[model samples]
Target: MSQILLIMASVRPSRVADQLADWIHARNTLGLSIETVDLRDWPLPMDDEPHQPKQEGFDGYRSEHTRNWSRKVDSAAGFIFLLPQYNWGYPAALKNALDHLYSEWQGKPVVITSYGAGGGGKAADQIAQVCQGLHLEPVPTRPALPLKAAERTDAGRLVDPAAAFAAQAADMQAALGELAAALHSA
Candidate 1:
C-alpha cells in the first residue's frame, strides 16, 4: 500500500495548519495510510546546504538534515500539502523544505491545498509553479479553503478547522482521489 504524507507547511506558533491536517487525516476514507509531518519539528536552517540540492543529488547530501529530509520525502508515495497563505503566497518554511532536496521529489504526485482569507488560490498557484521546477506532478483539483472573518477568532486563530472547512470536504476528497489515481498510475 502506498503511504500519503500530509505535510503541514506552516510554522507559525498560532497557525491552524495542524488542525486542518489532523482533520484531513481523521477524515481519510481513501484507504491509503496518511502521515502528518509538521515543518516546525524539522526546523531546517535556511540555505544551509553547501551545494545546491540538484548538485548534491541523492546519496550526495552533505548534511544529516538534508539526508533525513531526503529519506522522508523519498519514502512517501504521494503528498498533500496543507499550506497556509502568507502575503499572497505559501510560507517560506515550505519553500525551504522543498529546496533542501532535489531528486526525492521528481515525478512524485502532489496535491497543493491552501487555506487563507481569499481561498489561498494565489498561494496554491504559486506553489504549483515551484512544484513544476522540482518536477513534482500536481493534480488539477487543487482544493482551496477560504477562511472568512467569522470563522476566525479575535486573535486570528481558527475556531475549528473541521467545521470551518466542512463545505470543501467534497473538494478535498476529490483532490485525494486525484492523488490516489496519480500514484497508482506512477
Candidate 2:
C-alpha cells in the first residue's frame, strides 16, 4: 500500500491541529497507510539552507535537518496537510517546511485539509498556488473543517474534533480516496 503523510502543520503549544489530524487518521477507510507528521517533532529552521531548495535539490541539502526532511518527503507517495488558517493564511511553519525541500514534492498528490472559523478556503487556495510552484499536484476535493464558536474553546483549542468535524468527514474521505487513486496511478 502507498503511504500518505498527514502533516500536522501547526506547531503552537495549545493548538488543536493534532486533534483534527487524529480524527481524520482514525477514520480513514482507504487501504493506504496514513502517517501523521507533527511539525513540532521536526523543528526545522526557516530558510536556513545556503542554497535554494531548487538549486541543491534533495541530495545536495547542506543542513542535516533539511536532509532528514527531504528523505521523509521523498519516501512518501502522497501528502495530506492538516492545516490551520491564521490571519487568512497558513502557519509560517508549514511555509518553512515546504521551503526546506524542493524536487521531493514534485508530481506528488496533496490534499490540503484546512480548518478555521471560515473553513480556511482562502488558505487552501493560497497553498494550492504554492504547491503548483513546487510541482505538487493538488487534489480536487480539499476538505475544509470549519469550527464555529461553540466548537472551539475561548483559547481556540478544538472542543472535540470528531464531533465538531463530523459533517466534513465525507469531504475528507473523498479527498483521501482521490489521493489513493492518484498515488496508484502514479
RMSD, every candidate, angstroms: 1.8, 1.8
Worst 10 residues of 1 by lDDT: 54-63
In candidate 1, the residue pairs with backbone N, CA or C atoms under 3 Å apart (3 or more residues apart, or in different chains) clash, namely none
Give per-residue CA lDDT, model 1, range 64-102, as digits (tens): 888889899999988999898889989999999999988
CA error at residue 70 for candidate 2, angstroms: 0.7
- For candidate 1, the TM-score is 0.92
Clashing pairs in 2: none
Error (Å) of candidate 2 at residue 182 is: 0.2
After superposing candidate 2 on the true structure, give the runs of residues whose Cα lies further than 4 Å from its correct spot.
Answer: 54-58, 153-156
Query: Cα deviation of 81 in candidate 2 (Å)?
Result: 0.7
Q: Write the per-residue lDDT of candidate 2 for residues 39-155, one digit (tens) a residue.
A: 999989978888888544335778888889999999998999988899999999999999898888999999999988878998999999999999999999999988763366788
